[model samples]
Target: MQEKRDPLLNITTASSIEWGPCDPSVITNPALSCSFFEIPLDYHDPSIGYGRLALAKLNATQDRLGTVFLNPGGPGGSGLDTLNMLADILSSLSGGFYDIFSWDPRGVGSLTTPGEIFCFDSPDEYNVFWNGTVELTGIEMTGNFSDPNDVHALLAQAPIMQAKYDELARRCLRHSSGKFLRYVGTAATARDIVALADALDGPGSLVNYVGTSYGSLLGMWLINMFPERVGRVIIDGIVDPTLLATQETATAFHELADADKTYEGFLTGCALAGPQGCPIASAEGQTAADIDATIQALLKQAHDAARRNTSAPVTSEIIRDELLSVIESLGQAALFANTTWPMLVAGVQAEAGPESLTARRSTRSARRRTRRSSVSQQNQTRSYSNEAILCGDSIDLRRTRMSEVFGTVIAASRNTSEMFSVVWPAEFYACPFWPVRAVERYQGPFNKTLANKVMVVSNTFDPVTPLPEAEAVAALLGDNARLVRQDAFGHTSVSEPSQCLNAVMFAYFVNGTLPEDNSTVCEVDTDFEIFPGVNTEAILAAMVPRKIK
Candidate 1:
């Protein structure tokens, strides 16, 4: 029997593609196979050359029931890398009934689809122009705005930030690759997913997918854009599609409402772990007060250092932002059994040592503003790719005045948690000055009756993408979407290993089953404990290579 396919006229599609082995240097997975397929550079215009989408797939151990498309959100993150990282777990969870697959989306700089969106002539050029300036600074959680000094210090950088972005817009616009800006929007990528599915599963196969963070946004776009094609979709760490698509609201308006709750949870988790597991925990298993004091002192030291040097690397704000990151990445493979939390504690303790951070003036002087030599290829390209995708997909903010932009920042601080309001607004700091819009933007009536039910997952207390986002999205999706609340800390369900959550997900992927209802709740099997905590002499002795006797 022949399967049907609705090949997109705009994108170059196929019934089947020749698969090739992945480069051993880049990735060494026996189960993985890689391929590149062409899509339109400008779907609206054919004369514009084509861009290729790079895809990787983990073959099913059994006969493939279907293909599950996964995306690691980043507007710039490599989907292939995600497939590599989670292939084993996803393979096991689904019982290997299906092949797990993903691709490097356009503008991520990994694929041959114009490589990546680059505006600067060279890495050095980018560093030189951005040197000493907090241009395109991703929010470092420094400088709590409750204090007038911190608020003023934060607000003062608005001018310099704006000037840098305006210049960046100019430089990016003049660059040859800037022409690709319109081609990289989420809408276009949504189409690319369809094209890929058609090629892999004979054109019209149902699109089953799992997406987290920015990938969640892509999932929303997919279901709404091609509702009939949805087989089973799970979107976690959701972005409120309605809020993000609005021009007046600004990207920051989606808001990180649960950030404060997550912060509280971090302190609480430390308290729970006690003195043996956490550096800041109390000996007698007390409240979060000890943890708070330890952190507050570090912040004070950082703040004092920032006061002396405007360009200090470790500011109160940076510490706060890093803490937010530490919280978000709580249960990552490395953080789970490694030194993530302790290093954070030890790093701060070392920085905030006996002399109150004045001991570190040797490096963060006004003279050493240029971190040119320190810029890695990964950081530079990821930063550049992040801006290109985020800004390109967004409604143009170039027309918004600097004052209006600053107003959003101030409002985010007042309305949301002042502890991390600065962080959310800085997520798309480049958007307002972004010079291009993708060829297509999905301003949606996101609620559509789809071919299958959509599963929306959220951590009860996600640091960045709050539960309200998933709540609103699920509600908007109405009967078509099932909301599963994971009562866990950290950014998403991945922060904790939850047997309940995994079972629900596997059931959905294997058998198009939605949770019993919108109220379905899943509990994680573990909590956020410091990984490999402090090793006692007894524990160390146990680890020693011993004779059988």
Candidate 2:
């Protein structure tokens, strides 16, 4: 017989637990001391109630309730960090009605929960993981593997690493009394939001929730799971979960291509505006091709340099870092587009100092040098995270000859998405070779048949989740769902400019209001108001202005 379910326990919400002195660590560093809070790892476990999650809270004067959880949507990202960055923007936009609070999930950041299989012990180790492993033969680099077997073989002593992770996870789960490792999906996390609310108070407890990217998916899941429980949900950079599962390849490939387009736009925009005129433009025209070639050439140079510098039997692992940086740089549309302005400003500012030009040149030169090795390392780490979450949460792969099956798909699809087909290949090329499949598989309809309050926002030219995948997600939600089309070119529309779409989101979450139609199309940023700002430049200057005469 199954164990009897305990009757729900009634707990009183505490008013202002003194909040302890704001941790200077979070504030001084901006990176560290943000907000601090703790959650019992095993809310139900009585024997070892030791696990606590350190958190940070960011809010404007308009904040009413104690806090609101801010999720930035990285299964691996630090929520605390997300809130720190968005606090000002959110406050100004929302008129400061709620405090934004975020915590490192069970396995991440300062939470210290358990089940930490990540081998991020030292900078060198982290660098290695970030750069990933490659199968480079002779002087020229060749193929790379995302497969678990290949990775395991490469990290021959990885058993020790694996054991460390397994032990931590076991301890955390055991202490937390959480047996739902299989249920740690978005749905479960949504339910946890309810538990958090209950622990705080009912109904009007939290001010509102603001999420971006994966955060939006979590919001959707939460709203679906408990409609009446939600107060205000601001989901930016929205992702369609349903499409994410079923249309992984189709979505990913298209997004990658879209990324190339966005890069082209950035390059074009920079060229037209000129380096000194536009925040992003480099010293000269610094065309897009120049940037791309600069990055790629850096890799070759780094590899050659390393070869010459090291005759003491250098490993592919060492050279892979520069390569990983190159590959990852290709997908940095969001960063590249944003960085130009910042980098240009920084570069100009650096030019004023005696060592300014030298520093700037040195920095770029260093980046160019490491471009090759870094790419390999980044891919390795990313591949690990991808496998951990994707494979761990996905259904069991019963297909025999996984590699051949995926290889066939790649071959057939080469006509369309050639790069992806070549890079990702198929099941044969997958990481997490022996992933622990979810005990309960995700069925065709990614979500439960709840009323279609699901609001999906997809960019027309997203470089990650393609437009088609967004449509597929909306379709999966069926008649009850809605698809908000952001006529922008990027991943996750909410984060991009589109005040009209944002206003729609505010109305829906604030008052349970939905558009009359199931689909709403928003033009690009130039066509709409940028939220949280009537004048972004002035606001930015006021908030973090440069010292001037």
Top model number, lDDT: 1
TM-score, cand. 2: 0.60
TM-score of each: 0.85, 0.60
Residue 322 of candidate 2: its Cα lDDT? 24
Candidate 2: regions farther than 4 A off: 1-18, 28-50, 59-68, 115-117, 123-132, 135-187, 203-208, 227-234, 243-257, 270-387, 397-431, 434-454, 478-481, 494-502, 505-514, 523-549
Q: List residue ranges in candidate 1 displaced over 4 A.
A: 1-8, 121-124, 136-144, 248-253, 282-285, 311-313, 332-382, 527-549
Cα-based lDDT at residue 350, candidate 2: 37
For candidate 1, give the lDDT. 0.68
Candidate 1: worst-modelled 10 consecutive residues by lDDT: 366-375
Give per-residue CA lDDT, model 1, range 168-212, as digits (tens).
788787877677777888888898888778777865789989888
- Distance from true location, Cα of 180 in model 1, Å: 1.2
lDDT of 2 at 252: 33
